[model samples]
Target chain A: MRMPVVRTIIGVLSLVSVIVTVILGLFITPPDVVQGNLARLLYVHPPVAWVAYLAYGVTSLASGLYLWKPTRSMRWDQIAASSAEVGVVFTALTLVTGSIWGRPAWGVWWTWDARLTTTAILLVLYLGYLALRRVQVSREKRAKRSAIAALIAFIDVPIVHESVNWWRTLHQGATVASIGTNSKIHGIMAWTLLLGFIAFTLVYVWMVILRYEVTVTEDAIEALNISAWTLERENEIGSLSDEIAGLLSDNKDRTGTSSSKVR
Target chain B: MISESIAVAIKDLRVERRSKVGLNQVLPFSLVVVLLFGFSLNTQSRVLTTIAPGLFWVAITFSSLYLISRTMRLERENGALDGLFLLGISSVSIFIGKLLALLLTIFVLEVIQIAAVVILFSVHFESIALICISTILATVGIGTVGLIYGSLASDDRLGESLVPLLVLPILAPIIIAATNCWSDALGNHGGLGDPWLVLLTVFAIVFLTVGVSSFGAILED
Candidate 1:
């Protein structure tokens, strides 16, 4: 009951925010001094990257909580799985948008920049996490394995960033796509970026909630099916014994002389 | 715990000796990669020296996939992992033992790789000490993390195919640091202090600790 209402509210809020974000990002915001129209991608690309990172961060936190003894629950596992699934999607979007933005800005489809490389690695790491979850195992084992994998992968994030930075600095190559916040973004552009972040975050929240609900329903159906199968098997066993007892009685009736001899 | 770890390590070494899989299979695989690189690239050109560091690390990384999978496969055979758990041995000891064995095997593989690189690529070493230290730290880091991921992936039906997906991304830092450190040692680039080496050491310690502490959680049913 509560789920449907909350989901409805989130659905309405997300739709409104997304529409507003698109309008401001595409029409109202002014182009950059240098990048001009291509800079408009800044609104969507950075915010999607932010949400992707945010989703993975949530997954790591939920996984850590699930691994800890006091806070262990199926709720945490569900959240971890839900957020990871969403995180992988957003991560793929981040890579694709980053590539799209790079084509116009950097004059190439891809460059091994620190942020791009790190984001690509993040995508792979979480994809591996998702793949690990698909193994046919008991629920508890899957949860534990995935939680540890998430933590291990999370630890690599900072290292990947630092290493790529070190590599780039060593080569002394100029970073073409300057997406960092240090750039002088002002007025309508800044507002649109902020709105983009808010809208995407809302979208992520809405998606995760719906996905979690589906996971819960799937788990319930699986449990109900297992119990139904068990009940059916028990009934079959009972009927089998009844048939054996009937056959024994029929044989006893046919061989009444044997009963008298035994007496 | 220390004795148990030693016992496990010795047991793994003995198994490797009897089977000779690491020697006959993984080492040759590493050599073949180096040879393939030599063949694909113009060995006569100076470009070989310039790209040698990257090539060397790539070979090591690829070979690690085979070694990790082999290590995990040895345990998977005959349900040996379950037997180890049923023995009530500390999971940390098992992890440490596997880490030790992998480190030793990888170090040997690295030594051979270095020899092969020098003979084939004609790399002139500027600083032997830096290269050796980085190799040791990076090997430890790779070994510890590889063992953990190997165990995790071995449980899955995908088996060896899942290992690289789990490992290579996590190993990005080590590979980068190692390649840069080697570049610096070869005098291809100016010295950038010891930051990469420090990163390697830090990552090695962090991974070793994580692997040790989390082994029990991952290994249990």
Candidate 2:
């Protein structure tokens, strides 16, 4: 359903929650015993990374649906491309916030570690998918091609993670299992982190909704242009046919008069 | 299907033979990439030796970008793609055929490149079998995946730039796994039959299957 009201509600809810998350995370939430102010990024990085993963997952799922025969549609392709673009944005943000947090915590802006490297590759991979979508092909052709690319990319992610994991001998801590659920993080800090996740996810939903609407409108306009061109051509052809018919009748009338006069 | 693929492979090889672009042009370009690497990374033989295996694969991969595009470009430019369809060759057969041709060309390029690396970088690899296996497996994976993107991007104007951007990220695992395997073979840092080999083998098989199955869809205009 194209529920404008729901989209607006989501937009407002996300904005309010994000502002609340910032207030709680920046000021209200207590600093960590160890990382201190750096821990405030805890409310930002993980949630954003989570949304990035979420976006890719949605992109892959939508691409899958598009590729499958029973569910094939350009809308799914639109969804896949839109989600991938948003995913690329969030993935970049994840890297930025991560390294911003990392420079203080890990003493470096970037590390060639597994998760970080995988996320970086993830960003590039979807960016490539976005590039493929931008190729000027017919809608169906673009959809099929990009869907295949997206699915290949989706499958490649785990393999990319695995290969990078094998390549790396170091660890990035158990940030995976511990985020948003660590017993050490409790009360306001935990609440704020949860709020951050929900807020960012809501924002992602709103963004994808708007992006999807834009693509739909674009395709509609393109279809309208094609139809208008077709109609104009048809009118031109119709007038030419009318002229041909009139000329044929005039010639016939002239021939008939000449034949009758000769007879 | 096998015979058709072989026929298609032969046609591609013939086209390359007549064109001489692979040897006369791309070979020099790749070797120059090696020379450029030596130029940029310091002229010390020690550093070049240390990075020789990776430099070898990087050069090969770089050349394959052109080779892949070139392999498809002639057929596309000449409109032989549709002609192949009319020849009763299935898309799978055509995919396999082009992949085989690309792999053969890559193998030749890799051989020459390794020789260049050995001469220029003063590198000695301990495990010949390991090098051969890793090279074969990695190229298969890369070629299979490359053809998929080659067909997609090669038929367009932005293809030359777009191929590397689209293909490289997906092939990251292959590059990583193959580089490690080669490092172990050359540097004696690891043992044989490591997980890297397994990753390479799996990458090859997976993409081959993916390439074979999806060729029909991707080949459709």
Candidate 3:
């Protein structure tokens, strides 16, 4: 009851914020000096990238919690899976929006820039995580396997970024620099960017909650099926024993002189 | 711990000796891969020389994947993995031992690969120390992480196909760093080998620790 209400509220808030963000970003904010209207990607791309990283961070943390003793539970596993799933989607979005922006700005659909390369690798890593989750196995095995995969991938992230950076870096470094009085971007643009972050973060939170409910429901259905099957098996055994007892009694009555039901 | 690891490594090596699978099958397969690269991108093409390091490492990476999965599946096929657990050896020892055997086998395979590349692509190797150290560090990193994934995915049903998908992306650093380091050694580029070496060493240390610490959990039912 409470969960759905919270989900509803979050869903509504996310929808409204996203709508407002789009309106403001498209209409209210002015264009950049160099990038011109291309700067509009400033709002969409970074926030999506942030959400993607945010989602993966939650995944690794939740996975660690699941792997940790005393706090280990399927709940954490579910959260990790939910977050990874959402993270994968947002990661794809990051690449798409970034690519869309890059085509006009960078003059290519893609480049092997450090950030771009790392993000591409990240998308594949989590896609693998999701694939591992879908393999037919017991619930416990799938959770443990995918959780370990997530943490291992987490360890690779920084190394990948640094190695690629050393190899080459063509992408611009840190656009915001600062958000407030000392910001690189001055007026409504910065605020629109800020709004973008808020809106997408809200969207992430809402989606994860919904994904979590789906996983929980799937788990509950599995449990229900198992419980139902066990009950059915128990009933079959119970009726089989009753039939055996009845057969023994009928045999005794027919014989009338037999002891212990013809034994 | 060292003795236990050695014992486990010897045990796996003995199994490989009797089987001779890596020697007879995987080595030839990887060599053919190197050859395929040459055929696909003409040896007469100067670009092949430039990408020779990348090709060599790509073959090695595939070999790592194959050997890792095969070794783990060998354990599972015989029910020996669980039985070995009952012997009271540390999972870390098992991990190190398997990793050692993997590195030894891959080292042999890489020797052939290096020669193949040198002859086929006509590349030179001047910085012997850089080549040696980078190969060792990168192989160790690859072997450790590959073993972990192999163990995780070694179930009889879906593991074979799942390993490459899971391990490839995480291995991006090794691919990039090792290729760059070798590029320097092969004289394809200026010597910025130190930074790549640092990345490999750091990766090797970090992943070795991660594998050793988590092996028990990963192997648990």
Task: Sort all candidates by TM-score, best to worst.
Answer: 2, 3, 1
Ranked by lDDT, top first: 3, 2, 1
- lDDT string for model 3 (A58-171, tens) is 999999998887888999999999999999999999999999999998899999999999999999999999988888789998888888899999989999899888878999
Which residue pairs show backbone clashes in model 2? none
Candidate 1 Cα outliers beyond 4 Å, as residue runs = A169-183, A242-263, B42-45, B86-88, B188-193
Evaluate residue B220 in candidate 3 and report its C-alpha lDDT on the 0 to 100 scale: 75
Comparing chain B with the reference, what is the TM-score for each candidate?
Answer: 0.94, 0.96, 0.96
For B69-146, candidate 1 gives per-residue lDDT tens digits of 888888888899888888877899899888888888888899999999988898999888888898899899888889
Tens-place lDDT per residue, model 3, B1-221, is 89989999999999999999998999999999999998888666578888999999999999878898887888788788887788878888899999999999999999999999988888888788889899999999889889999988888668678999988998999999899899888884535347888899999999999999888888878
Q: Place model 1 in a CAPRI quality band.
A: medium
On the 0 to 100 scale, the lDDT of residue B220 in model 2 is 79
TM-score of model 2's chain A, to 2 decimals? 0.89
The residue pairs that clash in candidate 1, if any, are none
The models' CA-based lDDT, in order, is: 0.86, 0.89, 0.90
Model 2 docking category? medium
Q: What are the DockQ scores of the candidates, in order?
A: 0.73, 0.73, 0.81
Q: How do the residues B65-107 of candidate 2 rate in per-residue lDDT, one tens digit apiece? A: 8998887787788788999999888998899888888899999
